[model samples]
Target: MIFMHIFSSLCVRTLTNRAHAIGDELAALFLLANVCLMVMPAAVRADETTGTARIELLHLWRTPGEQAALHVFRDALSDPSMAWFDTPVQGGATGVRKQLSDLLAAEAQPNIIQWIPSEELNQLFDLGVFRTVDTVDEDFADKLLPEIREVAETDGVLRVLPVGIHTYDFMAYNRQLFERLGIELPTSWESYLALGPLLAESGVPLLSVSDENWQLTAMYRTLMISEFSKEEVLSMARGEADLETYRNRFETTFEILFELRRFAAPDREDLRWEETVARVERGEALSILLGDYIVAAFDDPDKLICARSPQSSYIPWGFDSFVFTHVDDPVLLQGQTRFAKAASDIDNIVNYVMHKGGLPVISGVTPDQLDRCNADTLVAWQKRPLLWEGLLQGKNRIMAMNAVIVTIWRDETITPAQAAERVIDAMSRP
Candidate 1:
């Protein structure tokens, strides 16, 4: 009952952890709820709809290209000739979780919700909050990128359709600015750290990042994966590994975090990710550590140079996906199928890549037509591994670790050794 209460309150806007750490207690509670729900199958209704079926899709993305791409799905799902049903796309970032929680509580709810095929979401799937789309169309499965196909499915049931593959932890720099400064991009972590003071001396911010929790989490995760081997990161995520077991790796990771703070833009605490990228675009900053979505902000490929995060063999990536609801209404079920078809359409997938500046998940949607930087990112994507497997699968471990790193970054009093202990302590809590 307490788990249900927490689940019911998750979508409460006032309680959402937008700017701070997602509390360890709340995350643990959800983990318990997820474990209990695993034994029960999600309920599906077979009730026939007596009237027109209308469904709402809730999403957090907001960009001109994303809006346009979403409109394409809107039109396709609304076509009268399709005999299934009409659907509407609703956009919002604030209060989206609250909205989803409320919607899922209804007997007749929206047909689909935006989903990312990650460990956290898979827990929701296990709780029966979403329905499988594996049988919707066999062809859709064939179109998914090989790297993400297996992750999209749970226990042989596919619950989401991936729209695009994204690299959340990569470095993007200003080519023109770097050329003028006569400094080559660093290829190793040590070399990269060495640039901090040099860039500071030149009055150029070496990197731009946001103060936002999720962004901080992404940065922390990037460093963790880079400093530790994949096996170590995965083992830590599984609770089998601890800071004491790999103190050197953990301390080194936090030391890198603090060193970068030395050259970070002064206004980083107040700037949103878009504004931070703008610092690089305007040549006020030499480079930025952010998501591939930053590419969408650039007008020309040559203006920006993308690279695998320095000293890292694998890049942390994410993908856009949608989860279906199991409503009994025939019309709504038909609408769900129609929406999936539109999402899987090659033309739509291509349009998404052109507009959103990421690698389309569907096969055959090549990046040949994209600008040089974007095309290069796609090519480089093949060399990196998605961070979804093992401990990186869920948001809790990474977020908890990031919360500690963020504190250490703001307080000079905290040493890397102490930060390492804090992260292990936070994550080890029951």
Candidate 2:
């Protein structure tokens, strides 16, 4: 159960491929937030052909549903005025962020990015690499919830333009499969664990998950956000809550995370998030705890019993965005403005978010406009703050702490107490 071998081999491959760039280890040592999102003349892939404004994009949407929403922009840009080109970046946005250590070491910006709020991305924002949302529309602030607008305008700068609000902290499963298992739908993480024996008889794992760093972080954060009260989570992030104050809850939470191995697919180590959902769709597993963005993978959204986290009376939420990096070219600026204008338009963004199973960032979206899970969860989520991303408080210390959880999961010798101590230590570090 020493899964460090998997991480080690993966690191070796990355090191060999990157050849002389810093790996995750050295990047952690330096503690830079993200590789600077600076683009050299060659890095900025803009070409003007017959007055067509073209933009090269690095994004994370690949599913049919995801593609459907993406096509909204694609179709919008096809009118000879502007267009977007896929700049292939491996591992999507979250992957791009995880690989930033090497991205900086190699003086390259190729992979890993998650649109979550962070101190590192914030640094890049302060440096003015990304354009402001107001440039898209003078009155763009009128379209979003005041709080969402506030997050978009953190520090009074409107740099991040969120297209859709979403949450990956939910667990969704096939209702028929749950009924066939002859057990009631488990309402919370504790209930789910209590039913483990019954679920085992059905010859399927109870959950499906991805094993990579960012995905694992999402999984861990989902549980942490769900188990603790919003106020507690906020306080912990603010360094107001000490370990002794919440030691029992912290240990119990980590224990539940450690126990997840009993219910997860055995070979999910290298599976894409989509592949994990595929297993659930085919009934190879009973359910998957993932973001609502993957709703396209299911054959029927109505048949799925989806809820925010295995626990969480209140939904944990976040968003997906199209962040624009500044380029001085008029055509590229026009293209970026056109893309943002299209992304936040009521009619346009609705279609995009619906295809991806998320709520539109534009105001006036009613439940009737959404799918079952989203419609059912929307009201409660309205009152909650953004999930783990909002809780980031600008520290990448979550990376080091997540390593402790992974160790606890992959090695039984590391007790939850030990993991909790390691987490407390990570939180205390500079």
Which candidate has the top score in TM-score?
A: 2
Q: Write the per-residue lDDT of candidate 2 for residues 146-233, one digit (tens) a residue.
A: 6577667765666677777777667788777878767676767888877666678767787787776656766887777656777776
What is the per-residue lDDT of model 1 for residues 67-156, given as tens digits with 9 covering 90 to 100? Answer: 665667777666443433223333222245445543333323567766555566666665666778854566677677777777786665
- lDDT for 401 (candidate 2): 65
Which residue pairs show collisions in model 2?
93-113, 94-113, 95-112, 96-111, 96-112, 96-113, 97-112, 97-113, 168-291
Q: How far off is residue 386 in model 1, in Å?
A: 4.2
What do the candidate models score in CA lDDT, each in turn? 0.66, 0.64
- Which number leads on lDDT? 1
- Give the C-alpha lDDT of model 1: 0.66
lDDT of 1 at 51: 45
Lowest lDDT sum, 10 consecutive residues, model 2, at 33-42
Off by over 4 Å in 1: 1-55, 75-95, 105-108, 120-123, 134-136, 154-157, 299-302, 328-331, 364-370, 389-399
RMSD (Cα, Å) for all candidates, in order, is 6.2, 7.9
